[model samples]
Target: MLFRQFFDAESSTYTYLLASGRGREAVIIDPVKEQAQQYLTAIEQMDLKLVRAIDTHTHADHITALGDLRAATQCVTLMGEFTQAECVSDHVREDDIVDVDGIRLRALYTPGHTNESFSFVLQPERPEAVFTGDVLLIRGTGRTDFQGGDPHRSWDSITNKLFRLPEETIVWPAHDYKGWTASSIAEEKAHNPRLAGKTEAEYVDIMNNLNLPDPKMMDIAVPANLACGRG
Candidate 1:
């Protein structure tokens, strides 16, 4: 499998692209609207066919380039069971396999950060990795105190769903606020401050401590992303 990762330092967001060596197909995940050309250029450089674009969940920070991707490429779009999903060709479900070119991604409906948030695993018929989105991160996990979020459920998603993966399974999150990236189930199990062997009530308490404000760009970004970047 071929993979490319890019970071938008301003929003602390990371977008990724994956393709098969055959280069006959490719997909973009968690793309940022402002960084659309970066993906296009990468596709052009790799000589791959852009077949699909997806987001693990509706973004609350910067708008995504999904709209732009649709208008620019003949690619199918996806998101996880979103009531307000923008241009999603598939309301991805747990265990649903998303095939693009020669690569396949399996959706894991590990909600908690939001009802529709998901983590996807890329299994290219070999050793593979997972894109954990906001559900799980390197040393940190996504806040479950925001809109449509729940801390107790987040605890289940983390300790049960995510930790169930093999210890060697690598993780790449949607945003890295700590300049952090990459982790294994073992690493997160041992080191994740908020999730390490904590009780459900304790987890809830910790989550409640995170009094985060709403994303500054949600109103503008959500609709723009849903519309595929309407002018």
Candidate 2:
């Protein structure tokens, strides 16, 4: 298993590259549209075959490179199974195992940031990690204020699903507010400042009280993303 993490400073989003050590086949997760060359160069230099480009959900930060990657490498495009299918060639389901050459990731549908969101668990000695799209972040969680974002649903997913994971499991979130990298479930439970032992009503109350603005890139990203990168 080979892995690399790329952070786009502008949006604070993290892109991950996971390649199969055996066959050199790779998958790109949440790539930035502005940096197609970076993604291509990395794969090209290693002589790896690009198989899939996946977005944990429709992004509110930046346009994704799925279409660009497909045009260049002919890789399959993937997203949450609940999202509209036109954009996602592969609709990933909960517990569905995605095999990329030698690396196999077990999918866990963790919907909080969005009803369609998912978190992937990479197996083996359990590297004790999961790629959490927007649900569980270093200091905060994704806002439940958009099209598919619901405060109640988010509370359920975090408390019932995500928080139930091993306390030691490391979390790689989609974006970090303060430029942090990874965090542990134990750390979040102890200091998340949001979930803790609060009731769902309290969680919703807090979210309702926040007059947060929409993501800067949402106006451009949503339409284009839904059209599968025609934007």
Candidate 3:
């Protein structure tokens, strides 16, 4: 397998590119518009064709590269079925499989950072990794304060849905502010301050009382992302 992780320092966003191997079809997740050229360069250098570009949810922090990548490579743009981003060329339902050049990701509807959020499990037949957009993070969880967010749902999604995956499945979150790279299901379950030993009520309380400020780009990013970054 061929994989690359790109970081957008400006937004603390992590973009992922994956392929079965060089010269094969590929997919990208949570791409940042500002880094479109960088992804293109890597794709070209690897002799891979970009077949799919996916956004796990409508991000409020940064504009997406979906539109740019599609225009550049004619790739299909995708999001979960519940997304309001009609600009996406395709939508996957829960348990739907996304296969590109032998790499498969099973879509999981795990909303609550946003009502429309979705996470993808790589090689779902025997899970290897999970791309958790914002619902589940390395050590903390996403803020359930806007975009139809709810603390109760966040708790349910993380504990009941994500935590059920294989303990060793690698966790790849969309954003990380403290320079941490990645974590595993077992690691998060064992040490995550927000979820480790907390009950559902306690988890909900934590999410509800985060008291964090909105992303600086929310005002612009949300609208732009709804249009697949062309807004």
Against the true structure, whose lDDT is highest? 3
TM-score of each: 0.93, 0.93, 0.99
Best by TM-score: 3
- What is the lDDT, from 0 to 100, of the residue 158 in candidate 3? 87
TM-score: model 2 vs. ground truth: 0.93
Q: In model 2, which residue pairs have backbone atoms overlapping below 3 Å? A: none
Candidate 1 off by > 4 Å: 124-127
Error of 1 at 110 (Å): 1.3
Ten residues in sequence with the least summed lDDT for candidate 2: 120-129
Model 3 Cα lDDT, one tens digit per residue, 186-218: 999999999999999898888888899999999
Where does candidate 3 clash, by residue pair?
none
Q: How many backbone clashes does candidate 3 have?
A: 0
